[model samples]
Target: MSWEKSVRRVTPYVPGEQPKDKNIIKLNTNECPYPPAPKVRELISGLRYEDMRLYPDPEASSLIKALSGYYNVPEDQIFVGVGSDDVLSMAYLTFFNSDNPILFPDITYSFYDVWAELYKVPYKKIPLRDDFTIDFTEYYGDKQPNGGIIIANPNAPVGIYEPVSKIEDVVAHNPDSVCIIDEAYIDFGGESALPLIKKYDNVLIVQTFSKSRAMAGMRIGYAFGSKKLIKYMQDAKFSFNSYTMNRPSLELGIAAIEDDVYFKETCNKIIATRERVKKELSALGFTFPDSKANFIFAKHDKLTGEELFLALKNAGIYVRHWNADRIYDYLRITIGTDEEMDKLISFLQKYL
Candidate 1:
């Protein structure tokens, strides 16, 4: 403990409990219940043993090209990393160098503040409204004083989405500050702010394959922004780690993006199941904000979030719960497959 006083001491962010038992129904993490695209498996199965000897593409060129083709953004404007966590962490280091406090929702991805603290960057968490909706006025670039901004479109845990026009307002007006729109769950039911990049050089739209692409284990995430912004991030990434994406991940990420039909199909399936579950939860006296992401933020009339979370855990069904203020009563349930959801609903019927 006394190794070095100079070593930075900081409390790290805790992730969702990943139970070891494979038999348990895990909806705690918002991972895609479906398997990765068939092409991903096919590509992995065909991976060459000789490929691992050398390092992956330092810049993730081929994967970036694949993303450019799929998202229709230029390659130079794209940047890929191990995951959105890595991308966001690098972004915080690269862009949020100013001494002023960075702004984000009080109840957000949690990692936002972790990265901010890890890098010793100043940050402020603006509280969401009573209904769990963000006040765009609080983050207005022109009206507010800020060093940087990051908003999760179709925000996590809460699962609510902000309109693209509202998001564009923040970007367009914040012409000087760096504005990042984290779109990890945009594939579920929200409109992406990706197109805004063309109009605003200060904006960066980050997306992850973990949710919709069913490649959480593969760990692929990317960002789209102006070439100038990407260039700065790219330089920061190389300075940190040249080869972030492994060869297998790069290949599989490309495969996942290529199967656009399968991608849409999987996302639609989750969305359909989410809508159906909403009705059933409502019948059980639960109320929640309309979710556009892959999860639902629900609170029951009688059942406390802690009670339900523990009860479900005892029953071997897992859902996410937070102990934070304003949302302590809510449970964040990931939309699993139809059968898994049916099981969850059936199990809850006894309590109803």
Candidate 2:
């Protein structure tokens, strides 16, 4: 209460719980269940401790070059940040300056509203359809001015992936406003809108190494856009903090990108496991959306989400549950390894 009135006094976003015990099977955060590519470990262990004395690359040149080559985008079009959260926050601060409200789905990433409030940006939530799918047309028609648009493809909590064609429709209609696709979970199953960057100058695609690359602990995230948009976000970033990247992250991130075979194999494994678990949970009388991401959002026929969430927590199996309206009965479960999932399923068998 003693802080300045203008200081950030808004309610903050609460991330999934991180328990102290290592015995817990954490299925709440939607992080990659497997380890990062072996090269990451090899590279990090060999990295000289003496290099920490010097500041890391301000522009994150090596990693950007690797990403540019992998995604076939130009190096100049890439923007690297602490995490996708940082990149999105910078994007919100930089691109959404108009007095008009930004647009996002009502039940998408919980952090969207927190960032909007922290930056004092105006934003409006468009309702998801009855099945929790995005209606691409809801963003069109010019009835109201939108400052910008952002959506999580394979949206968080719901785990429903919108097709690329639908994404194109939204970006095409908002030619003047920045349209950002938060593709944090795209690597699992959804088609990427990265190709649209070549055609639409106003589009931005943000992704993370935290999910697919299993580097959540490393905190690396990046974005790609037209040269103009990238340049503006870069300017905003440098102004905020020039050396946002550190020595270990800049080096290890490049290692993660170089191991393409391992990356795809890990994603494929998670996808396979997700499909199998979906069938098992369904057999247990749970109903969920058709998930294309590395997680499933489900509600049991006889159990409230809160009840099941507590039951799993006591059993040392963690998954996410929200108290928010429309989703209070749902639990968002991250797809972990086969063994971990077996444990989860066995624990849930008692509910039947």
Candidate 3:
């Protein structure tokens, strides 16, 4: 049998390739090159085989408690999911009704559009400004009724961030519908929109352990919102998958949260590396958007994004290339260790 009409219209999201060989410098995905905190490894190592036989806690109480303490939000205001992508998907399902269109930036995480199609929700893509920054004026001027909004902070590929105040202004103006701030990369440098949740019942903030905490393999993400908003997400979660976070991931997520020092240090290192990379890229006649995430979006006047991406791949380094209309010339390169970045710079100097 053929797939449904909605599936026919959908273009699936393409994640960065995870190569089998460990030799490649994987700078395509914005994953931390560093390992997770020692405590997380220790906890995972100590997990009993018996725990695998039983089902994980459906509520993931300990993880929720730890996150509540970490973010200073109440436990009832939190909802845990397999990953921030999962959380985003749930939010799409939970908040966006079939009658109203969902709104997001034209050049965003890309998955946002996919999720909308998967859920059969109508959507409007608001284009970014000429300089690659989001124009809130165009977004809110649409005057759509009963629709929701989602934007990635320090937004993917572009790596530019919206100030917390700007996000607050948007939420204040749109009290009638949900406003989701996907902070998947916020820990790198962007200020969180979590504080806005206290004032706006419509605000929902999504975060993950994958990037900052070096827990991509664990697949743990959580959302913070008003109790009423979180309840709807919880209901959606129950309907889709009652227990998204497994036992080992749950335990290690708690450990990762408890070890705040490790998390901060790792994130600081990535930020430092990012700054250095930006400086070096500028010196090479490459212009990039101001970055607040672990990655940078850069393009050289002499080269196309696809050309640079292919050259890097040939040098055993992988970076992401977007051929989307306005951003076709830019490459999204993730920050790795000092040595790895040095290698990348050296390669670019010769190639460009």
Per-candidate TM equals 0.98, 0.98, 0.97
Tens-digit lDDT track of model 2 for 1-352: 5568657778999999999999999999998989999999899889999988999989999989999999999999999999999999999989989888999999999999999998989999999998999977879738557999999998997989998999999998898899999999999998999999999999999999999999999999999999999999999998999999888999999999999999999999999999999999999999999999999999987889999999999999999999999999999999999999999999999755
- Show model 3 residue runs off by greater than 4 Å: 1-9, 141-146
Ten residues in a row with the worst lDDT in model 1? 1-10
| Residue 114, model 2, lDDT | 96
lDDT of 3 at 37: 94
Best by lDDT: 2
Candidate number with the higher lDDT (1 or 3): 1
Per-residue lDDT of 297 in model 1: 91
Error of 2 at 259 (Å): 0.8
80, model 1: CA deviation in Å?
Answer: 0.3
**Cα lDDT tens digits for candidate 3, 200-301:** 899999999999999999999999999999999998889988978899999999999988899899999999989988999999999999999999988888
Question: lDDT tens string, model 1, 1-352?
Answer: 5778789767898888899999899999999999999988888879998979998889888999999898898999999999998888889989999877889999889889888888999889989998889998999766677889999989877899999999998887777789999999999998899888888889999999999999999888899999999999999999999999999999889888889899999999999999999999998888999999999999987878999999999999999998888888899999999999999999899866
Error of 1 at 29 (Å): 0.4
How much lDDT does candidate 2 score? 0.93
A best-first ranking of the candidates according to their TM-score comes to 2, 1, 3
Cα shift from native, residue 194, model 3 (Å): 0.6
